[model samples]
Target: MTALHDKAKGKVNPVVAVGVEVDDAGNLDDVVLYRQQAPHTYKQVKYTVDSRSPLDTSYLTGPSKNGGPSILRKVADAWVALTRDGAPVELALVTNRASSPADQLLAGRDARTMLLMPAAAEQTRRSERGRLRATWAQATNLTEPQLLMLLNVLQFDTARDLRHLEETTSLLMLVNGLRGDHQAVRSGADWVAEQARYGHRKIDLEMIETAVRDQELRTGPARSVLSVATLKPDPLKTQAVHVLDWVDRFDGDDAFSKRRPRAPFTWQQLQADVEDIPHHLGAVPQVALTGSLRQATAFLIGATLRMVTNVDLAVTQRGQLWESAADYDQATHPILAEHSLGIGEDLALAVEVATPMTDDVLVFLRTQQVPVDRLVVLQPPRGAKDNAISTPAAAVALTVGLRDQARRSAKGHPRIHLFLAGPMGLSLLLGHRWNRVAPTTVYEEIRHSVQYEAAFTINA
Candidate 1:
């Protein structure tokens, strides 16, 4: 599992170290913390697989080669242990086995009968309960009184019809792929040599389930709870669709519009027309920048630019990084005349938080020909420190200072352009503070794109 975490790259949602601890025996289990939805929430997942043939009741009752408890009952016992431990978890039982009508995969209280059926209750007596003493004794301490509690807690989820499900895994391939992952599971014995070291590295099973659920959402029969948990409405994705529509219209591809010179808009107007729609952008009513992570800011910027903007950014003077950007701008982007809106104060807010870089962003903006009538530069306290805002209180103080500057600079203007050059956490918090201050369009640095573009609208 740790190796899998190491192998992951790019913007993949990495598991949070906190709240993702596993149980005593962790195979293809799931416990994650840092997702966009349900941050810090804990989950426990257990897996079972069967690829040989369709299951009669025996697959649930039959022991593995060494005659230990079956994986299904073991996982069920684990669930009971987890509940008893008071660890709040969303437990799941994942498997790739098609059970016959005789052996159904029931859930909750309905699942209790499987234990009473001939495969279990009758067999327990048939073996004179010796098998239970031999295998489940240490693991579950299965006494007669605890049998009902065991049945009540052990709700196993089944994946039926392997050949048709499209996502079924070969038992061997899965085991081999997880070759070195021994840290999560410690209770099992390697059946191969009765002692040869064997364990497969595992990841959170929820990751697989999430991907599958997302696919279901795209194709069919998406469960509402999961769909709501994983998919968020994106402003840029919507605006990108609209942009593609413009491209089609301009190309005379729209069935409704005939190719004509008299159309109200053209291909060149795609940028202008799309940039004009502000109030109708951003799913969130307010945006924030209170994270130190660049990816968060980058996402917010990309989404916002798609909604409403043509930005006039300023990158302040802050040593080599800013200098290099300024030099690049001078080399590639000779300033063009600003678009004449002839309305309100075409405001420009400078963000000198964390460091001094408003001038750098501004120079890049000039290359794109965006205009700014006023400059609202935000700064930290006089002698209080370096770029870091020091404390949450200080971060809030900076937010207040910026808000005041925004109001004073824009005067009574309905809209103002904001450029952020600060710690990601501070930026997000600033966005939250500006939530009440409507129509404050936020800009993001494109880093490598030759021309500057509006990243997204930041009303929220």
Candidate 2:
């Protein structure tokens, strides 16, 4: 990346600071740094020296490697850095290693780590410790898609030897080459203890980039740090990653084994891990809309351009975009036309329950004559609370209604084109219901003041 952006010197954001040690301990293996451009947003960079050996997902998801509790300490340091100054804390992770394919590390199904989630939900009359408490988060086993969305790990080709010291013997080779001597340095402290000090600390992103490109260390997929962090819609998600990393670390520690962390617990780590991975690959979107979020409410936009199979999707709320069919116009219809996702589809469903945007979306569909019927719109009671879906009960009720409407509409329509506006919880709830549904396409409206910039095709 440094090499790719070398010509545009100022364009490349230099790492603010690189730590070779810890707060008060020995030399830490991991590194923590923030981009010069986006401060308060930090990421933990951990490097593993493989010594010419091929690397794999084990380095990231392994029990001993970054996947284990060892990541806890690194996350703790990052968390401290994030909260120490009281900045709008956001966390992301980047692991620079050589000889590994980015795809295998990210989408390799075999490498998926099964995270333990309580099989039950809160409000259940569960035991304190005897019955293993039913309030085990409103989630099931930690899935790969969920994990990647949460663990947005970015991998770059960086060799350990190159990062460590760049062959100390070459310490003098540059000077020798400069003098046309072509001789290697005899010794480190022998030749010139003070000479090494002259430029020993002189290093920059350009230098690293140049060297990396010259040596062909960059492999697999080539993506920039900024490329991975452009659209971090949610800061809290990153925090969740941090907290989970802490818990993952704490779960092994003897001191905090018996006691659990407080609310916003495991949130910090979770936020850090999931925020950045999507920009680089679209498969794992802007964190899966889980729990009771009406998945159709706040669209899920996954950008997996580089990946072979990236799901580009979006979900809208009922009242979020439009009121009734009257909202549709020549201007708004183009935005939907630009989406062109299910442009030539069999069916169009407006998730009217999530929000009131269905009317306009439906109008746009009908105006374009894209096969939308009266049953395309799915809405709730006229006077439902604005924040009605905050509860699981409300979301479930909406889902039940959607199932009925969708089943009735699916009788004739083959492909599903969805335009929605709803809450995040309802969107997530909608995500679960689509597992067995037809090929559904969704849309996210990146709106301007009075209009939208473009209609992003959200993959279902």
Candidate 3:
């Protein structure tokens, strides 16, 4: 009966082009781009009249060479299917000179960009298409047409300047997905706090805390030591206390018994580690190693080198860059020409404990549109790691780099000052009078020092 109806109606087989659409839940809603429309009925009729089922020179009078009613019908059919499935669909002509008009149009563009509501909204606005999201951040999932439309908008000159559009779009989309009421971004604050208590750090917490602490870190020379801290809940603290108590309880030792002995290595250990790593890799050489910070600084830098890289302390001192800053005046002058102490990727990843300060790094971060978090102090030891210590040199460099990056990322995203330091390094940064100590001891001391220091607390 279906075949006889086709014969009487003079209709022939049609071509098919499918597009797959997906929502936030990752559901697929494909739309057929090509379908036969009523206007193309006459062409189908002509084909039916002229051709037999088995012998077809021109079986179906498809759309005109320029894409007539037949192709439009196919598109309409697909659109109807999409609408029926509760998927967002829109109609528009895409250009294609090299292939069939139907094929020339995209079935779907990159899928990642589509899942974002911001991208989808921008797509609809640019294409003059239907509103998929009721608000700027309202899309939970996206349809194929919506995704394609967004892709097209991104390709436009006007939208290209939107820095980190992909990231921002995705974040906004996620926020929308988690949004409860129409008014505010839902609070995962409790979850985040829990994670913090468990010693787990989240990027969002880092971002938010960084934003909050930026003002404190940037006060400059007057505000020498800026501490950006994320506090844990009482339960986590209680758990930590219990563990400490357990260890002490087992040892039957008092608080003083938990104290550590002085480290065997001196500031000279720093030079050894620095020289072992290549200069291009951003390893330090001979440090002037002095000041109150000397012991803690040397232990940290040396321990980090030993931990991340297996190079021996002896092998560290052999590098040409490991010479004293005073002795290498000529070399220093020339090397300083570069205007920044840029560390290699190895060092960066290795020394995740404390980041480095580099104008280029800051600029690079800004160029990538990275959000500013709290200030991360990235200081290079200026003196011999074994002997010399104490100075705000490292902190200064780190702050400069962080500020530079923040300004470039966005004018007012807020800034975060992170004073990353070895135990002694932080003390020097804080300009405190303290005895030389082991790296581990310094870590505990500095950690507690920041907590107790009245000056470290900001008005906010």
TM-score winner among the candidates? 1
Encode model 3's per-residue lDDT on 184-279: one tens digit a residue: 212333433544566443223234334324423221111001111111111111111011111111111333332222245322333343334343
lDDT tens digits by residue: candidate 2, 1-460: 2222222222345453332222421212233343564442334555555444434433433344334443433443444444455544444443444434432222221111211122112223443321222111112133333332233332232333532333322311221111101122223223233323453332345544444454443322221111111121111222111111223222223322212223454423433443443544333322222111113222332222211233322222331211011111121110111223344546666665434664466445645566543335555655223664543344545654565556556665666676666555355445444433455666544332222112223333
Q: Each candidate's TM vs. the true structure?
A: 0.32, 0.30, 0.16
Model 2 stretches with alpha carbons more than 4 Å out: 1-345, 371-375, 382-385, 448-460
Worst 10 residues of 3 by lDDT: 220-229
lDDT of each: 0.37, 0.35, 0.25
Off by over 4 Å in 3: 1-302, 306-440, 444-460
Ranked by lDDT, the better of candidates 1 and 3 is: 1
Tell me the TM-score of model 3. 0.16
Better of 2 and 3 by TM-score: 2
Q: Count the backbone clashes (under 3 Å) in each candidate.
A: 37, 60, 41
How close to the true structure is residue 13 of candidate 1, measured as C-alpha lDDT? 41
Using lDDT, give the best candidate's number.
1
